[model samples]
Structure formats: C-alpha cells, structure tokens
Target chain A: MKRTITLTVNNRPGVLNRITNLFSKRNYNIESITVGHSELEGVSRITCVVNVDNENIIEQITKQLNKQVDVLKVTDISDQAIVSRELALIKVLSTPNTRSEINALIEPFRATIVDIGKDSLVIQLTGESEKIEAFIELIKPYGIKELARTGTTAFLRGTQRTSNSTKNISIV
Target chain B: MLQETAFTKMKADNKPISGSELLLQALEKEQVEVIFGYPGGAVLPLYDKIYDSKILHVLPRHEQGGIHAAEGYARITGKPGVVIVTSGPGATNIVTGLTDAMMDSLPLVVFTGQVATGVIGSDAFQEADILGITTPITKYNYQVRNIEDIPYIVKEAFYIASSGRPGPVLIDIPKDIATAISEPPEEKEINIPGYQPTLQPNYLQIRKLTEAVSSAKKPVILAGAGVLHAKAAAELKQYAEQQQIPVVHTLLGLGGFPAEHDLSLGMAGMHGCYTANMALYEADLLINIGARFDDRLTGNLESFAPNATVAHVDIDPAEIGKNVPTEIPIVADAKEALKQLVAQEGKLPEHKEWLTQLQNWKKEYPYFYDNTSSLKPQKVLEMLFEKTKGEAIVVTDVGQHQMWAAQYYKFSKANRWVTSGGLGTMGFGLPASIGASFADRDACVLAILGDGGFQMSTQELAVIKEFNLPIKIIILNNMALGMVRQWQELFYEGRFSHSKNPVQPSFVKLAEAYDIKGYEINSVEEAETILNEVFSNNEPALLDFRVDPNENVYPMVPAGKGSHEMVGVKP
Candidate 1:
C-alpha cells in the first residue's frame, strides 16, 4: 500500500527546487506539494506528499533533508492522526440533463456550487486526501471541462498545538 | 520575566535597545566573549554595538585570517569558534576559511552584517547575499529578519554546530536586525522537524565485525580522522591494544592512535610507513574506523587490503558503502561503536609471528629521510619534537614537509596534531598555529611549512603581531612542491608538473618584515643552535631552514601497489 508522507517546508524561492532536486537525486517521485504561510512570522510551511517504497531510502532522505539550510524543519505526518484536505474546483459540463446527476455527486461530497453558468457548474470540495481523490475518480466519467487542485493542507487530530519536533521539516 | 519587563521598561525607560544592541546582547548571552572580524560601511551598526559591548573583538589583518583563527581555535578547543564580518567583500573574504573548516569538519559560527531588511534584494551598495555564497559550505545557515529572532538563531547555530558532525554555521544579520531591540532572549529549541540526527550503531553488524576481527589470523586496525573527530582516540587505542591489532593511520587520521604507542604504525598510503603498508597487505581483516578510503589511502582500490575483510565504522552513512565497500558497515560514531566492540569481544590472543614480522619491517626502514651533508628537513622535524618533547601542538602545511612531519613527529595525544588533510590546503599552518597558540596560551604551537606553502598565507603574521601570539613558525625552504616533484621524478620523468616554478620571496626577510624574530639554518650544526635559541624564547619566532631540494619522501609503495613493492632510496 502506498502511503503519502505529508511535509511542511519554508515558503521561499528554490524551496520547491531543493525538495524536488532531493527527490530526483534519490530517484524518488513526489506525488504532490502544497505551499503556504503558517501562524508564525518569517516562516512559511510547505506540505509535500511523496511516494516511496523503500523505507530506508525515505529515512535517509529525511535525515539528509534535515541537514539542508533552507529547510527550517520537516515532519512526516504519515503516522499522525490528522485531517488532510485538498481544495479542487471541478467545472463539469452542466447540460440541463446532467445538472441533477452533478448535484447528486456534490451532495454526497458536501461540496458547494460556488459558481454556475448556463452550461457549467463550479463545485468546491475539501476533506481527507483519499475522499478528494475518490470524488475526482467518480466525477471523471462526467463530461468534465476542467479541474484544478489547491494541493493539500493538513492538521493534527488532537488538541496538541503543533509539535516541538516540527523542527524536522526540511524545506530543502 | 525581567526580559518581558525590560521590553516594556525599555519602551518607557526611553532605553529601547537598537536591534544592533540586541544582537550584541544575544552574543553576550551565548558567551561569545570574542569575535574575530573586520568592519565595513554596511556593518557599521554592528560595529557601533561591538564598540560599546564588553566582548573583545580581534580585527584580522584580513577577513580570511579572522575566520581561519576561528577555525584553528575550534579545531584545538573542540568548541564552536565564532567570527563576525561585514557583508559583501568583508564577508566574501571569509569563504576560504569557511571551506577549510568545512573540509576539516571544525566547528565555527560566522556572523555577517547584511544590509537593512528593507534594502535586502534591492542590490543595495556594499550588500551581497552572504548566505548564498556560504550555503554550500556551511553545515547550517540563517538570515535574521527580526531582532527578536537573533538570540534564537544564535542558539540554534551553536546547537547545530556542536551537534552531529560539527562544522561551520553562518548567521547573516541585517543592519536593521542587528540594531533593533526587543525582550530578553527566549528559550527556544533548535529543532529540525522530522530531522532525526543519526547517532546509533547496529549491534548485529558490529557483532559480525567482531567475529571477523576475532577470527582473523592477521589483522590490523586502520584508524582515521573520524576517531579524532569523534574524540575516540583513547577508546581506539584501547580497542587496538585489546585485540593487539596494529594501528596504521591515514594522513588525516595520523593522531587517531597515540604516536608513542608501539601498536601505532604511523601513516600508510603514498607517504605511508613501509611496515604499515606491509602489515595492511598481510592483514586478513582490516578494521577501518572513521577513515574514508581516500584515493591517497587506497592508491589503487582494487589492490587495497586484498586479503582483508574490511569492517568500516563511520558517523556518516553515505561514507559507509561509497568507497571500498565494507564487509560490515557500522553507521555510528567511531567512539560510540568502538565501545560496543569492546563490550562484545574481550582482549585478543598474541600473534608473536605477526608482531615480529612487523617489527622487522619497521627496523629495516626506520623512517629516516636524512641527507646528512647539510641540514636535512628530517633533522628540523626531529629537533622540533625533541626540544618540545612533542608537548607542543604541531600544525603543518602540506608538501614534502608534511610527509616528514607525519613520519618523524610523534603525537603524544590526539587533536593535538592539526593539518589540512583532505583538501591538502596550503598556507594553513601559520594561521592555524596562531589560533592554536591563542587557544592554549601556555602551549607552544609549531606552524611547520615548506617555502611553497608558507607564501600561501604568511601575511597572517600581522594577526600574531596584533595579538602578540607566541606561536613558532618553522619554514622548510625547499623552493618547490617537493612532494609533487618526487612523484614527477619517479612517475613523470622529472618533468615537474605544478611542482617547481618561478623564484620565490625570501621568507627570513618576510618574517623580519613583520618585525618578528627570524633564523636561517644552512647546515645541520645550525639546526641545534636555531632550536636552542627559538625554544628558549617565548616570543613568536620563525626558523628558515635551507634543505636539499632533491630529497624525496621514502618508503613509497609506488602507485597501485602494496608494502611488498615499496622502493626506498636506500632500501
């Protein structure tokens, strides 16, 4: 089973390059990445989801990443009980015949029709990564016009603020 | 509490500390009593605070010397050394020292004053991204945007520097941040999220290593700078003695084993001991500790330790499987893992035949490179050690002189012997000597170098003059890169490649130019006179010795061969 390791990095130029460079050098594939600022000043957190089969290589890369200077810290939220969400807006064709079908799909996902034109509908959804992916898989059969993902944003499940060990999140 | 109150008190007390003041205060809190630096327009604010601060600042003759002194101090003291410089050229001057410290793994923290926050990235005058230039070399780096973050960043720099494989850390403080004032420094954890530093050894793998060593008929221990870096010299000596394993150090690992110990086989490889090379070839198991198998160490890797089953122990995992792949790779600090080996395997049985054979080889090639017609370079080394009883810390610049020092000078202790081993940096000895001498004012730091190497950084004498440091510098004036020439002579048909070149400056006059005492030795008789005069004096002195240019490092095992193929000039 493939598990996504979520990571937060400092938002800065070449940060994505540093992270991707690390993955490429190690021959590991990055599934996705989301960058944004945190509650702290002069700090930006980047959430990266990567794909790796070799645990040893993952552990080694994580150790190497922590050594990079741009990387403020790195945390693998893979084992943590957390909520991971992706913001994606799907503009599926809304012909008069398919409007009911699209509404039914949106109803199950608890998505909203943020915008609607005569021939299309813009639905916004947020939830666990798997749920978002599943929604995309289910809605793909519909005559979809365009799709855009806002990447992923994650948070811990408990009342524990963030973590002292978040220092491990390597930006590079 | 006072810090919080101070933030408000300063606001009301009309004593709002400038960001620069806070920068100095943070340094003071970190116990940074001295910072080697040079002031420029961009860092004027930091210089202003430094003026009022109690911290002593050593203005280097050059910014490079400031960083180098910090490196020397760190290498000898085992503490992270700190240096400060202005941005742009002032900061750029420190790169060589940074790279030197990086290559050697010496701990250092550099503080560079950057342009104000608003002016950053605007291509402001005298402003350059010091962080960008240093990022590749430093173990960690930071640019403080907020004055409040200065203390935290300083704390983190120290933590990161001394932790793991200690190396240099750079802190780029903007003029605004350096001058801004805030609350008292907060207690912050220097954390790298998910950055779990590797610090454990594999017991099962170590057991396999133990078995390999314990069962071997002929075994020797190859120790390296890692043992010195890990401060495991005593343990390494203990383990080598426990197994009665002969210990041969690479040039970098020279002081890993006690030089005076009978088990210590000195350096092995290009300029290695003939006996040590023989023992390495004869060994059934080679237990490598903290030594990277550099090309010089493994002249030809295919023939390196052909009969040996290698058990490698290092702190960096990448080094484990990278070179001369090991039979058992233990990813742990040498000091820590050696303790495990001791616990698992008890003292070893005697190998009378092996010991006798090694002794015979040692006797045959007694590590002498004397061409007694005049003052030999070897005699200068002998006299230096004899006068000091090897009590002084010896730092050498690389060349024909380095091989001689490694062969003749006995290291009574580890970390006491310092040099630019991996990068083979020249002009390192003088500045390193000044730093070493200053670090331990009581001890003599002998900066030994060849004519070629001395010119690389002898301008640092002004640093010694400024500090009134008493480190002695001994120059072996051979007028050529003799080590390189030796290779060219033997391998390249005497057509010197980057070996011998144009006429050089007179070093004795060079020392006199700095108003330091200088001595010139032209014969063997002058060596004893020079030694007596120099050793009796407490002032910084220089000894210029004229030695035969034709002398080559002996017991060389030719490239791609072992001890059996060693060709000594007299042997």
Candidate 2:
C-alpha cells in the first residue's frame, strides 16, 4: 500500500537528515518527499509518500517518525480527504510544424507553454499526479527533452488542521 | 574608567563562563556524582574543568571500557550513567557500548568532543560526524552549536536519557564551543513536544487486563528489563503472587523476578529453559509487561503463544504491537500499570492445574549438564552460585558462558545480573564489571568471560589494578568461540571454520603482569578449592578454568523454528 504521511517539525538544522535517516534505518522505501516552511514561525511541514505492505507497517512508520525529537506532529493523511497537487515542467522537442499542435493539445489540460525555444517547448503543469502523468504520456510522442517534478504537497480539503494549533506546545 | 565600570557591572550582573565550566555547573545541577571518562585532545578544555570539579572521574584504559563501566554503574545504581570522551576515534570507540545500552534500555548521557564548529565538515584531524553516526542508535542526539546552549542541552540530555523508556542520549560539543565564554542561558522546564511518554495506563485497559486475568485458565506473566527500569519488581512479584500467575523472564529480565519463587519459570527464548519455553507455548493468556517481543523470545511469531491473548504493558507505544499482535495494549510505566493491577478488585481464578503442569515440566526438564567427566561451564556457574549464595552482582560476556551464567547463577533481585543481552558485545563483561564494582565498594562483583571474549577487553585489567577494585574475574576457557562453534557444529556439520582459537596468550601471566592475583583451574576436581581460595580474600583476582571444548548450550529453539520445536531437550 502507498501512504502519505505529513509531519510538522522544528525548523532546525539537520532536521531533514534525521527524518530521512530514520526512514532509511527502518528500511522504509520513500517514494517522494516535499518539505517547506509551515504556517507557524520556526516550523516546517514535510509531506512524505512511502510504500509499505499494510496498515500495520504505516502505523509503525508513523510511530517511528513521531519518535524523532524534532518532529512535532505526524499525521497519516492518506485516507483523509485531501487537496493535493504536484507541479511538473516538461521540456518537449518541438518543430515549427508541431508547435501549434502541442499548444492546441495542452490547452484542454490547462497546461501553459511557459517557455518556447527554437527547438523545444517547456510546458508547465500543476495538478494531481495522475493528470501530470497523462499530460506527459500525451506529449511523449513529441519527445520529452527534459522533465522536472516537485513531489506531491497536500492539505486537508476543509478547515480541519493536520496538526493541533501550536499555541500551547513549546517550539524548542 | 567607563570600560572598567562596564566590565565590573557585567561581572556583577551575570558572569560569563567558558562552555566547559558551564557544563560542569549544569552537571552539578543535575546532581551528577560520578563520571566514567577517558581524556583526549578534543576534550582537553573539558578535562581541565573536570580537574577542579567535585565530580569523581574514573578513567578507563580505553573509551569502550569507560562506556561499559558507565552502563554497569547505571544498571546497579538506577541512575543515568554519564560518560565523556574525545572526538573521532574516541567517540567511535564507544559505538558498541552505546548500541548495547540502547538495546538494553539503560539510561546513559554520553558527551563526545567534536573537532571544532568550523572544521566539523572539513574532515579535520581527529574529527568525525558523531551525530550522524549515532542518529540511529541514540534516543536523541544534539550537536552544540552555541556555547550558551550547553546548560540547556546537558539538562535536556539527562532528562531524555533517564525518563520514560530509558536509553542512551549523546551530546557532541565542538572544541571551540568548549573554549568559548558566554553568559549561561536562563533555566527553563525541559519540554520536548514530540517526546512525551505516557506514564499512566487507561483505567478501561486496566479493567480489560483484570477481566482477562480473572478468566484465564492458563495465564503467564512475561517480564523484561522494563520491570527493572521502572523499579517495579516488587509490584510485579506482588501481582503475580496475588493472581497465582507463573512468571517467565526475558534474558535481560533475569533479576526482575526472584528465580527461587515457585511461580518463577526461569528465562524464556532461544536459549531459555525448557519449562519457561513450554509455559509460553501453552499459556492461554500472556501478560507481557515491559518486554518487547524480540525475535529471540518469540521464535516464529506465528507459533509463539498462538493460543494466547496478549496484554502488553510498556512505556513505549511502538513496542506494544511491533513484533507480536497485542490484543490489549497499555502504554504506561510498568510500575504504575502493575500497581493499578494490584489495586483492582477482582475474583481471579486459581490456576491449580496449570501450576501443577508447569511444576511438573520444571522438574522433568530442569537445566542439567554432565559434570562427572570434565569441567563443564555450567558447573563453574553452579559452584559460583553456591559459594556466592547468589548475592554477587554477576556480569558476563557473550557466548556459551553467558548462557550458562543466565541458567545456573540465578539472581534474586533486580540489577544483580548484568550482561550485554541485546547487542551481545563480546568485550562487555570486564569493563561493565569494573563499573559495577564502583557502584558499591563492599559488594562482590563478578565478571564471567569466555576465552575469546576475555581477550577482547583484557586491556581493562590495568583499570582493576589501578583502582584495586575487588572484582572476581572468571574466564571459562573453552579455547574456542563457543557459541559460534556450537552453531557451526549444529547447523554447518561440524565445520569449525576459524571458530577455534589455536593460539592464545597466557591470561594468568597477563594478570600477573598487571599485578593482580591469577588462579588457574585445569579440572573439575580443583574448581571448588580454587574458587574458595579466590573468594577467600577481598583483592581483585582472575580465574582461568579450562573447560570442555565441545560443550553446547541445550534446549535451543533453532533459528526460524517455533518455541515448541526446541531441540536437545533431555526427554
């Protein structure tokens, strides 16, 4: 099973290394990870997608991640109603003859041609991972010269928070 | 005049202190009385402060010995052990001891010197990324970036090490930080948001446990090191007696329950006794307190206590359902949980039939070995137990001799039996015993070692001689790596494969060179007399017993086999 776990951790040096080291030590396969500053000051939110066998393994992973000192909160948002998105920039081989065809194909998907080179077109797509995969598949015939993807980042669909308000909890 | 007045005012307000001096003050505030340490280049500043400090420092010949000694001190005193060592090799040397302490859940606060904050990543001389290396092994670790953070870091390190499920915590201090001067940070409550460990069990879960206990026809209590760590041995004994439940100990839990008690079914696991293993196999309910179901104890989880409903009570929530599927989970301190069980009102069923069955199994398959012909390692421990009356704090190195000691030398109280149960490090016994001897000067501390293991830390003999520690060092000389040899004999068709030590130094001569009394027992006939002569005085002594080379520990549940499928049981 594939699970997405979100963690709110202290914004300190080597925090990411500690989190990654934990996953590696437990032999958990990390499919993707995205980290950035959270809403709170001096705190960071990390969203990690891991491959595990069953719910028990995810439970173990969450418990282990929660054991790290810098990790303030761990929430398995896999089963929650989440609004998730991933941005990918694909530079595809294009000729003057096929530029119009690529633009017409991308317009329905809401993907924009951010940069147009003499021989290539860089398409910027921000959507669910499946949508990006489909867009890439359609453009594969035009030859994908380069591709860059920012791993999935997510949030709960409504006002429900993944972590409790940090007003009562000490940051350091 | 203005500069002089400002300096005087600053001194009156809050004096600036070097990081080393600040660390000493923090340690004093923590009420640390002793430190097991070895000095080195990176730690010179700290060592200079230690020279004037009131803390007693016992310097071992090596950093490994120092850390193991610290473990021994922690185990016996029920206090978090404190250790200080230098950078790179000095820090790396204690890696095995750190891992050992971590696995056994012993509380230790180890301070290692880093090269310098600027040179940490430059691969400077005597520099190592200790925090990176120890991240997996430590409960938590910190690299002090600011001199002002020393006091808080030290306080937090000790708190984290000693609280909840105790384990080793490391603090790496850079050289420049140690030498820098700064005003101490204001003291505050040590609060780690993610590190809150549950100390109280749910009342409903206690009700569930009591209900299961009252209804169980064949119930067994599996106790581990947590019982000792929580200082809940008395509560555990009280609960077991009140409920009439048979108790089985994990390897490290040997002393958590009195072995002489009728309800006590010695140790259970791969090398556990026949009765203990069988009781675990047949129990209808296994009330595991403070024990993680390690593979060695479970022996194929599918067949382990298959008929039982497991109620696991541990301080660490992760351990409850880690190796075994726990039915009723209570995440709390062992002492608190046991106290609640004792206080609960319930009509518990008398397991007379189960008790009788366990008693019969115990009598039929008691731990035995043929001591008629040659010197058996079991006889050595048995004789030691008889002579010491099971009062000595016995420490052991890993291998066959360790198993024999766990089997024959029964401990009646917690913290009496100390060994590297989790990591099974070979060189642990001698240094650990050195630490144990320091816990109480009058008490007899015994270090039992195998020939192969004895040589691993024999350099520590210098420490014994230097301190004149009254320790009884016994080396069971099988002339081989006994456990590996036994495994190879059983699983590899007698292919020795470098298991036998063909060349070895004379341990007696080695002891004599260190100015310690050394005795040799070549046969079973002289074992008692030699033991008497060694224990007759208070001076430190070493005994080399040339035991049978081919002896094997029996009642083993072979790897990947079920607990019920133990081989080598005398039927």
Candidate 3:
C-alpha cells in the first residue's frame, strides 16, 4: 500500500535534500513528491507518497522526519478526508480529424486543450490522481508525444489543519 | 602613521571580535572547560584562537578518539561533550562516534570546520559535505552560512544536545564564516519553535499507573540510560524502595541504581542475569522508566512481559509503544515522572513470595566462572573490583569484556559504569576513559577492553601520557573476537570464520611505547599483585589479562527469543 505523508518545513536551503536523503538512505521508496509554498509565510508544505507495507513504516518515518531540525511538522493524512490534486500535460498526435474527438473526450473531464500544432495537440488536466490517470489512459491510443505530471499534493478536507500548534498524533 | 593605524585597528576591535573570537566567548558562556580535537587547515583560525584562550584543548592522535573521549566526559559528568575538528577527513572520521553517541543517547556538541564559504559546493581541497554525511546520524545539525549566526547556532546546539533524550548535535562552520567579523549575540533565552520537548508527562496517565501499582501483587521496575540522562537514579531508587519493587536495569543503566542493593536485579537482556530475565518475564506489573523497549530488552515482543501490565515513562514521545505494546504511556522526563510517582500515596502491594522466588533464582544461578583457567576474564574484573573495592569508574569497549564488566564489576554509585550500549562500537573504552578522567581528576577511571576493541583506539594512549590522566586500561586478551566467536560456536556449527585474530601485538609493548607502565598477567595470582600495585601507586597502566578464548557469555536469550526462553544457565 502507498501512504501519503505531508510535512510542513522551514522554507530554507537544503531542506528538500535533507528530506529526500532520509528517504533514500532509509530505503523508503518514494513514489511521488510535491513541494510548494504553504499559507504560512516562511514555511513550505511537502506531500510525499511512499510505498509501505503497513502503518508501522509511517510511524518510523514520521518519527525520523520529526527529528530533522528543518522539519516543523509531519502528518500522515492518508486515512483522513483529504482533497488531493495532480496536474499533467499530454501531447497526442492529431490529424486535425482526431482533434475535435480529443477535445470532446477531454471536455467531459473538465480538461482543456491548451495547445494545437499540425502534428499534435497538448492537453492539460488538473484533478484527483485517479482522474488524471484515467484521462491519460483515454488519450494513450492517440500516441503520447510527450507527458509530464506535477505529482500528488494534498491537504485535509474542511478546516482541519496540520499545523505546528495542532497536537501531535500519537506514534501508533 | 604606524601607531595611528594600530590604534585604529584596536578601536575597531572594540566593536566586536572576529567570528572565531565570538566562538570562544560562546564556549566560555557555555562553561565548556575542555575541547577534544585535532587541528587542520580549515580550522587553523579556530585552533589559533583556542591556543590563546583559557579553554583547554586536548589533542588526540585521531579525530575518532577525540569524539569518544568527549562522549566519556558527557556520560560520566552529565554534561554535553564538546568536539572541534577540521573539514574533510576530520569531519568524516568522527562519523562512527557520532552514530555511537546518537544510538546511545550521549549528549555531544560537535563543531566541524568546512572550506571557505566561496568554495563550499565546488568541493575544494579537503572539503566534505559534513552536514549531508551526518544528517541521519545526528539528533540535529547545521551549517553556519553567516558569521552572525555562530552564537545562536552554538547556543542552540548545546541546548538541543543537552536537553530531553540527549544526543549529538553538529555545526559545520565554513572557514570564512569563522574569520568574518561578528559580535556574540546577547545571552538570551532560546525558543526554537520546532524543538520544544514535553517535559511534564500527562498526570492522568500517572494517576492510572499509580492505581495499577497499588493493586499489583507482582511488580518490577526496569531502568535504562534515561535514568542517568535525567539524573533520576535517586528518585528511581526511592520509588522502588517505597513500592517494594525489584529493580532490573538495562546494560547502560547499570549504575543508575546500586548493583549491591537487595532489590537490584542486574542487567536484564542478552547476557543478562538469569534472575533478572525471569523476573521481567513473570512480573504482573512492569514499570519502565526512561528505557526504550529495545529488541535486546524485550525479546520476542509478542511474548515479552506476557503477564504484565506495562506503564512506560520516557521523555521521547516517539519511543513509547515503539517496540512493545504498553497499557499506559507517560511522556515526561524520567526525573520528573519518577518525582511525581514518588509523591503519589497509595496502598503499596507486597509480593514477598515473588521477591523470595527471585532471590532463589539469584542464589542458584549466580554469575559463575572457574578461576582455574589460564586467566579468567571474569576473575580479572572481580580482582579489579576487589582491588579498587568497586570504587573506580569502569568504562568498557564492546564484546565479551564489556559484558563481563557489566556482570562482574558492581557499580554502587551512579555514573560509574559507562559503555557503548546501543551502537556497541569497538575501541570506545580507552579514549572515553580519558574523557572520564578529565571529568573527575581525583577519581580512578578504568578502561576495560577486549583485545580486539583495544587495538581499534589504542593510539589514545598518547592522551593519557600527555595529560598524565589516571586512567587504567585493561585488555582482556582472548586472541579473538570473543562475542562473535561465541555466537559462531553455538549457532554456526563452530565454523569460526574470521572471528579469530590470527596475529596479535604485545599490548605491554604498545603501552610502553606510549611511555605508560604496562603489565601482562596470565594467572589469577599475577593479576591480584599487579592490580594492587597499579591501584596503590595511582599510576596509569595497561594490564593484559590472557583469558580462555573459548569462554562465552551465558544465561543467553538469543535474538528474537523471549526472556523466558533463555538457553543457558539453568535456574
């Protein structure tokens, strides 16, 4: 199973390397990682998906991450009600004949046709990770000239926050 | 014109000293009396400043020795050990010590010099990415980019290293940063938003534990290094006595309570006494104070303390329920938790039958050895204790000697027994004893080493000679890696692959080469006389006791087996 661990860290140089290095050295296989600025200034939120066997792996990793000086907070929101998003851009071969059909396929998923060239059309989609995967599968037969993904970034639903002030979850 | 220029420079100096100078001032503020280090190109400026400063710098032959000595000082004195080493190899050399200290929870603040800031990432000559290398091994680490940040970083390093569940902290200072002009920050309270530790445990949990303690008929207390780190030995002993509970300690937690106390059950783990393991297994209530339930302590976790309702008290919240399931968890300092537990009044339950059962086990399976062998290692420890009357502070390197030291040498006082319990690093004893000697000038410090472990850091003999530290190094020469050899004998059909040392040096000559008196004893009679001479004369000496190479530590609970499943030494 894959678990998503969200961390709020000091927005400083080398914080990213410090975190990734821990994953590499400790042999935690990171499936995807996304980093961006958080609502709080001077703090960045990092969401990482790692392939793990059980909750014990998350507990160990979270404890190790919490020990890092640059890391402010670590929470495994995998079991929580979370709103997750991933963005991907796919360029599919088009003959001008298949372009309208591609547009129609993307329209139902709320995706957009951002670019059109004689050889191909570039489709941009932002949605839940599964939705992005489904859209990519729909366009794969048209020939994926190029592809890129933003990885998975997530936050808990509603007003629940993973903040420094929030009581730490017990190390279960 | 020359005088005017000199005066101008002097006036500028009054504004604030260079970063190196401010570092000295910070050390003074931390009241760091000694620093263990070796000089190098990157740290030349810091070294030069140290030369003119009041802080004593003891140069070791190797950087590893410096850090281990620092660890010894920290473990014995209950102070954060300080280390300063140059870049590249200097920084890399201390990795083992850093890892060892981290695993054992020894408090240390290490400062490693880096190449000038301009050449940092370019990988200039003698430059290493120390912060990157030490990230996982240290409790916390920093790279000082600005000279102004030196005071704060150093202060915070000390605070973090010495505070709750102490471990090593490092600051990688580039050369340019050290030479840049900067004033020491005002001595102010440090509040790291991300680093606050829970000092007070939940009182409701304590109340629950007190209720359990009052009703339990068979209760035992297990103490660990946390007791020493929190300086809670007195409180722990008080709680045990008031509750009339038998106290068993982990290896590193030996001295936290008197080994001679009737209620004390010596070291409960692999190579632990039979009675202690039995008590841990059969107890109805197990109170764990400041001890992580390490695999060694809680063998076969599913079956560990099967009959017990466990209440764990530790400072690190992450350690609770980490390895073993606990009915009640209290996150607080050992001293604070023990203090609270002591204050609670409850109807104390007496388990006279349980105590008597443990006594019978102890008497029947007392740690025994036949002195008729060439020179028994256990006999050496016994005589050392008899000669010193168990008054010396004994530090040990890992392997058979370390186990025998824990078993044979009784520590009746706190902070008297120090060893590499977690990492079990070889070659820790000699230099650590040097650090311990520095901590107490009048005390007799013994470094008990296995032949294999002694050779790893024997170069530290120079420190002993230079400082004339009253540290006695005893090498139990079995001519093999005794611990590994024992395992191979039992579990590997006696293949004995590479565990035995094919060739050995004369330890007496090695000690003599360093200008310290040396003795070699192959018999119990010789050991008794030589040990007495060294003790009475108060001279630093190394005694090589050649013991039976085939001897193995018994009352063994093999890895992953429950304490109740001990294989040797019948009760």
State each candidate's clash count.
Answer: 27, 0, 0
Q: What's every prediction's RMSD, in angstroms?
A: 8.0, 5.7, 4.7
Candidate 2's C-alpha runs over 4 A off are: A159-172, B1-13
On the 0 to 100 scale, the lDDT of residue B148 in model 1 is 71
lDDT of 3 at A93: 98
Per-candidate TM-score against the hidden true structure: 0.79, 0.96, 0.94
What are the DockQ scores of the candidates, in order? 0.15, 0.64, 0.45
True contacts kept of 3: 0.40
The digit string of per-residue lDDT tens for model 1 on A31-61 reads 7777778887656777767767656656656
Give one digit per residue, the lDDT tens place, for model 2 in A14-38.
Answer: 8999999988988999988999999
TM-score of chain B of 2: 0.97
- B155-245, model 2: which lDDT tens digit per residue? 9999999999999999999999999998757777888887898999999999999999999999999999999999999999999999999
Q: Give the TM-score of candidate 1.
A: 0.79
Interface RMSD value for candidate 1, one decimal?
A: 4.7
Q: What is the lDDT of residue B476 in candidate 2?
A: 94
State each model's CA lDDT, in order.
0.78, 0.91, 0.88
- Tell me the deviation in Å of residue B430 in model 1: 1.0
* Index of the highest-DockQ prediction: 2
Could you arrange the candidates by lDDT from highest to lowest? 2, 3, 1
How well is each residue in B208-321 modelled by candidate 3, as lDDT tens digits?
999998889889999998999899889988999998899999998998899999999898988899899889999899999888888887788877889999999988877877
Whose TM-score is higher: candidate 1's or candidate 3's?
3
